[model samples]
Target: MAILMFISRVISLFLMVVLIFYKRKEPALLMAWLLLLVFLPPIGCVMYLLFERTPLPRKAGLFLNDIKDERRGRQASVSLNDKITSLVHFNENYNSSRLYLYQDFMYFADGKSKYQQLFKDIEGAKQSIHLQYFIIREDEVGRQLVQLLTEKAAQGVEVRLIFDSAGCFGTRLKYFASLMEAGGQVYQFHPPTFRLIGLNYNYRNHRKIVVIDGRIGYLGGMNIGNEYMSLDPKFSPWRDAHLRLVGDAVWELQHRFLKDYYMVCDHQEDERYIKDHLNHYFASPLSTTLCPMQIVSDGPDTTTDDIKLTFVKMIQSAVHTIQIQTPYFIPDSLFLETLKIAAYSGVKVEVMIPTIADHHYVYRTTTSFIKELREANIDVYFYKGFLHSKIIIIDEELCTIGSTNIDQRSFKINYEINAFIYDKTLTRQAVHQFQLDLENCLLVDDSYEQNKSAWIRFEEKVYRLVSMLL
Candidate 1:
């Protein structure tokens, strides 16, 4: 046993040296792992082994390359404001997200309205329906969604669904047996290989997207659950944001869904199937409204942090005002610095977060940044109820809404998506809604941190030390 202990110490030291060299660029992440190793060597080594980064399957890359080759020169050029032109160009070059003119943009601040419209669209589906969510509980809402998709599949409409295994941990594959029996396809995103070992557990697919009939698309924060509708007493009055987009933008969403589908779908199936259905999946729609939008996505499969960089660009372009709402606020150093710079430049910067705690360590880590953020002259507001919306509005002319939090997890670990809208009308609508939410918020002034109990402050410090892993 003494020899075994010595060997473990040697291995841990070796791992730490290797990590310091390999992850030198990510200082915060590297520090978090180093702290973990110092305290618990065995557990930290096992975690590092399980969660180490690896590129996406080679077959997935080949599939995306073929699709990219076919999609070249398909995007239409559009005139954009000088301030946002660089931001748009960055997303196009790095994320390969094309711009589209959406005819209709409907924003939902409540889950009831969003799910009602989503179900209606599903009922009206004629050809295909693609739905993806990070969580799908075994509750009334989840069952209803499965039933609806089963009915659509029974009606000869192609129905495809993807859910993250880690997010829906207790959910079994049998939960989707009925949908599969009805001829609908359901795939779990990166399930565990062994009963106790899940290689992709740390990297989750956090995107919530829906595409119906190649014409309508939805993407945002609300997942499929009764809690999202405020039916759960623990998290009553749940607040979130979702977007229902109609027009050519839906084609971009459809393309994104197909890419994820191809990643998990059987590669043994004839590749000709995707080629044959390309036109059907990307049918163009004629619309009059010119609402410029870009559907941007990022994941751990690539090295580029596209969404985080896009957020940085958006904050940098701010001239008059910036408002951000997110449940989690454990941002990286760069993100925190950008917001501080914006405030220093006289941009009215405001951020709203929830007063409640869903995850104890994560919530504590979020509060840990409050003192630093407040010192930078940024106003911080704690919503009276649970605030789950991931939104950022700039100058009442541009806004982003989707399933991305202001944290390292969303920026680097999870598969996330967001819609960057560059329309004055839609952006102002978002700003107006944000103002309404602010009425129920409690501002954190100079004395807010002084009143905190010693225990609470200590918890924050402990959590903040390893926040990057959260």
Candidate 2:
């Protein structure tokens, strides 16, 4: 018994040392892991092993290394206006994403319209179609998408898809068998291993991207599910934001898809084959219009949280107004503090979130942050229905639309992509949409804090304690 106790003590000490030395983690996250390790040795060690290990294997970096030099060379030659150039330099320097001038842009404020346009683009695909989504239900909408892709595949179009294993847990493999039979390929991101145990459940592919015919692209928060279409009665009137892109921007989206595809499919093709295929797919004619834009992506694969840093840059750069819409608002301390600073600096900061939540704990935890935000002079508004849009607009000249949420899960855990648009016309359209959404929102006043019960407050504390893991 003494020997066994000594072995356990050694293991505990090892884990404590590992937690303390883990680099790049926030101080609070490090402390939380340390507490878990000290209090619950066995369970915490197992949890750390399964979830907090290396987020992305070192081998994953090789997937995109072949094109890095070529892309950087091309980006260096692109010219931009003064305002757009500054933003581009920031992203290129900090986020490592290059800016491209898109010819056309279309914004969708609802899933129905987004899906309509997506299907139209898919139907017109002549060469290839690439799609990636977090969730793809086996419901009516999913069936229709599968059918369409299968038909396109049958017509000799290259159709490839990727879905998150955790997000599509309820979706059966049989639902996609027909597409596979029709010569299309489907891959699941980070599927369960070890006999159905998901070790990578903490990291998910939450990006929604569709590139059709190597010329048109779509992305945003709307997933391929009935819930996003308001067909799920539980969360009806789903409000989301999506964008359609046509021009050089599609190439970046294509590059992102190829990286993800190579990682999942484990393609062993030679470098020559990869280079040839990339050149062919990215050879689409450039658009005549020059609308400044940048496609930024971030994931657990890298130590730097580029999307979160982009958010901070947006807040810091805003001079007059900052508007945001997200389904979840359980932000990290840095995110909250940045917004507070922006508001205190005389910027009109407006944040809109859903009054009804699909995740109860997430909603409650979001409510817990309201008191602090209001005290900082930030305007907080709750939409009457579920608002699933992830949008941010600053000064009516810059805006971002994508799958990233204002929560720890999106900022630090999941894979995300956003399109930063630097155009007055598009920004004005986004601002108009934000104003329209304000009609459906109720601005929270001082009474919001006074009405919370003791149980709710306790629950908030408990949820906040583990918010990093959530």
Candidate 1 regions with alpha-carbon error over 4 angstroms: 52-58, 64-77, 194-198
Question: Which residue pairs show collisions in model 2?
Answer: none
TM-score of each: 0.94, 0.93
Give Cα-based local distance difference scores for all models.
Answer: 0.84, 0.83
Model 1 per-residue lDDT tens digits across residues 88-197: 78888988877776468799999899989999999999998999999999999999999999999999999999999998997888998988999998998878663233
| Clash total of candidate 2 | 0
Residue pairs with colliding backbones in model 1 are none
Maximum-TM-score candidate: 1
Candidate 2, 227-346: lDDT as tens digits: 888888878877899999888888788888878887688666634555667655675645767677888998988878899888888888888999999999988888899999989999
